[model samples]
Target: MSIQSILDIGKSGITAQRLALEVTSENITNVNTPGYSRQTTIFQTSFVTEERGFPLGTGVNVAEIQRAYDDFLQTQLKTEASTTGWSSTVLASMKRAEQLFNEFTADGLGKSMQEFFAAWQDLTANPQGQPERQAVLARAQQVVDQFHRINGYLTDIKREANQSLEGITSDVNESLTRIASLNDQIKLIEIRGARANELRDQRDLLVRQLSEKVGITYLEQTDGTLNVSLSLGPPLVLGNKAAELSLEPDAANNGYYKIFATSPGDNTAVDISSIVGGPNNSQGRMGGTLQVRDSLVNGFLSDLDELASSLATEVNSLHSAGFGLNSSTGLDFFTAPTVTSGYSGIGGIQLAISKTADIAAASVDPVTGGTGNNLNSRAIASVYDKVLATSGGNMTMEAFYNALVGKVGVAVQDAQRSSDLSEGIIKQLDTLRESQSGVSLDEELANLIKYQKAYEGAAKLVNVGTEMLDTILGLIR
Candidate 1:
């Protein structure tokens, strides 16, 4: 080869090696960086003409630095990761709820109910005893207090869930805005025939993050922009624009929250609460929070009210049929009162008995018109047994409360199981992606050695060319 040609080859080789070295260095530097894709320098030979045909030189040029990635695999990983994230969040919240309602705990409602019933049984054994009457009243008060405490805890949990939803919504909106801005930037870059791969990575990362707060689906538009939506059909981010979501008090209940979406064109409000409440396997933290608020808490409170009502009614029926010793007339030992659904106030029916009933002269069978029987102890004991034997003697109010607590424990266990499974899946997917896209220090080191050798060979070529040229000049001299 001619000296000039050789020089040209050496120069191209040097350039290629330098570029390869730089790429290897970049990979090594980003080895610990999260979500950083390793880069590789693409090389191509320069074409040359021979005597009879085209010839190729040993020189090389860097075509481009390619980022290692598998688009389809990344998409799958992101989707799975999002689902795992949401399930984990909801599981944590549910676990907290379970702990709050633990029936096995010392201060739980189950224990309180049991203690109340046991106290009633003691009082029933000696209905005319002043000490036993006071004990019954005290136990009854404790039962009411326990209900109040449990209801209060449920209210607190609901309130906290609502607050968490609000925070998540704010974060989602921020991410949407960021993604929209990224869309605009990526579109502008793509319009110039440049691939905004880094920007795209950033946008994808944001989408994954937003998905954890509320399940989302996205589509890539023809313009290389993204359109995002919640599990519901409403748009969240469209191309270079984003929609705003706001929380408002539910029409039926001022304390409850309803979700609304804003249109980008004119900022018109659209109610999305029903849509959000629809059946969806893609429900995120927000949906779980709503379920806890509306269904779990509400159901427990309803059950409590039912138990209270039943107790009052049954006791009142027996009490009203028995005659008081102080008077010839019969009086109710317990009064039934009206209860409102979803109401948390403590102003309901109070269990009270006639304090003036002469225990020695009270009649158990007023229907038989008997008097001076002093059967008050037997009458009270019968009422207590009936209360304990309601629902086919299988479930007392105390047992019912215990069952409710057990249900909460089971729910928490189920949530934990789901969360663990989802987390494992996410980890597996992440490991696969990292193996494909993540930088490796050992690979970078090997590339560095190869590039160093190529650089030295190119330098040696240039040196030999210079020496040969100098020798020829000396011969001419």
Candidate 2:
């Protein structure tokens, strides 16, 4: 080769070696960086040819630093990851609620109800005894207290769920703003035809996090921005812009919060409670809390009202139909006003037996109470049987509550199963993505050795060219 051609080759070789070293160093430095893809420099032959176009001399030139990535596989991974995240979040929250109810536990509400009924059975054995009546009253009070405790617990859970929703909304809004900022940055970076791979990874992670808070879908726009939406069909974030969500007190019932959305531009409020089904109507932990509060707790309250009404109606009716022990007077043992329906509100009801009994009329025996002429304990016993019968053989408010709690167990199990299936699908997708884009240490090490050898060879050529030039100068001297 001529000296000039040799010099050119040496210079190009040096450049190729320097570029290779830089790429190797970059890969080693970012070895532990999360989501970082390894990059490799492509070297092309720079050929010197004669007029006939036949290649004579050649050296290497660094072409492009290609990023090891698979866009299609990554997209698939992110989608399944988002779905898995959502299901897991919902399942966790539902499981927490299930633990609160503890349906099968001996100390749970179900057991408390059973004890109340057993107490009632003891009272029924001796109706006239004050101790028996007092026992019944105490047991009845215990049942009421248990109902109120469960009701309070349900209310607390509902409040907690609302708070969780509010927290999630705040998180979503913050994430949306961050994503918008990143979007603008990515657009600027990509304007010159360079891929913002690291920035894109950050954005994908954020999107996955956002999906867990609510059922969400996102679309990539033509301009390289993302459009985000909730399952309720409302836009959460649009491109580089975002909408805010807030909670407002319900107009009809100030106790509950109604979810509302506000635009970023003008802050115009749009009610989203109906769309998302409010805190209680949601399908996850929020839904479970709502069910416990409205249906489970309220149902128990209704049963209590029924028990009180039935007891009052049947006992008062029997007492009014016959005379007391006093032959001179005929009066009811307990009287106020009869409740027409089991659903009637509890008001103006009191339990009291008449103080006086007429013993003057001798037509009836006092020992064995008569139906019409004397005090009839049999009448009271018949009414007690009616109360027991109305309870559907269980005779206690607690028994009814236990039955309801059993249904909650089935719901929790279903949610767990769904979450497990979703997680499994997500894991499979993740493996596929990792195979496509994830860095392999063995592969990277091999690449490192190859690049190192190329760099060394290139540097050697530059050194040889320098020595030859020195030798030519020495010969001239």
lDDT of 2 by residue, 1-477 (tens): 666677787778778767776766776777667666667778888866763566575667776777777666655555555455544554554565455455535655455444544544553444334564455455545534554454455456556655666676778778878888788878888777766766776787677666555556678776677777766557877767787878776657436676677764547788866555444334333233334333444454455455555555655555555443444334433334445332223233343542434211212444455423323434444443332554446553334444445545565676578678767876786666566655677776777777678667766776777888899999999
Model 2 pairs whose backbones collide:
113-398, 325-358, 326-357, 326-358, 327-358
- CA deviation > 4 Å runs, candidate 1: 1-5, 47-54, 100-107, 263-266, 277-279, 323-335, 343-345, 349-399, 462-477
Q: Candidate 1 vs. truth: CA RMSD?
A: 4.0
Q: Name the lDDT of candidate 1.
A: 0.69
Give the Å error, residue 319, model 1.
3.1
Each candidate: what lDDT? Answer: 0.69, 0.57
Worst 10 residues of 2 by lDDT: 354-363
How do all models score by TM-score? 0.84, 0.71
**Regions of model 2 farther than 4 Å from truth:** 1-52, 56-93, 96-105, 263-266, 276-403, 471-477
lDDT (tens digit, per residue) of candidate 1 on 1-477: 677777888999898999899878878887886667778888988875573465657578787778777778766766666566656665665676666565534766566556655654564555455676566567666766766666677778777877777897798789989999999999999888766766787787787777766767888997889988876567888888899989988868656788888854448888876665444543566666666676666666676666666666665565566555455445554446555443323666465553644222244543364543445535544443353543324565656666666767776776678778867877887788788888778878988999999999998998888888898899999
**Prediction RMSDs, each to the true structure:** 4.0, 6.5
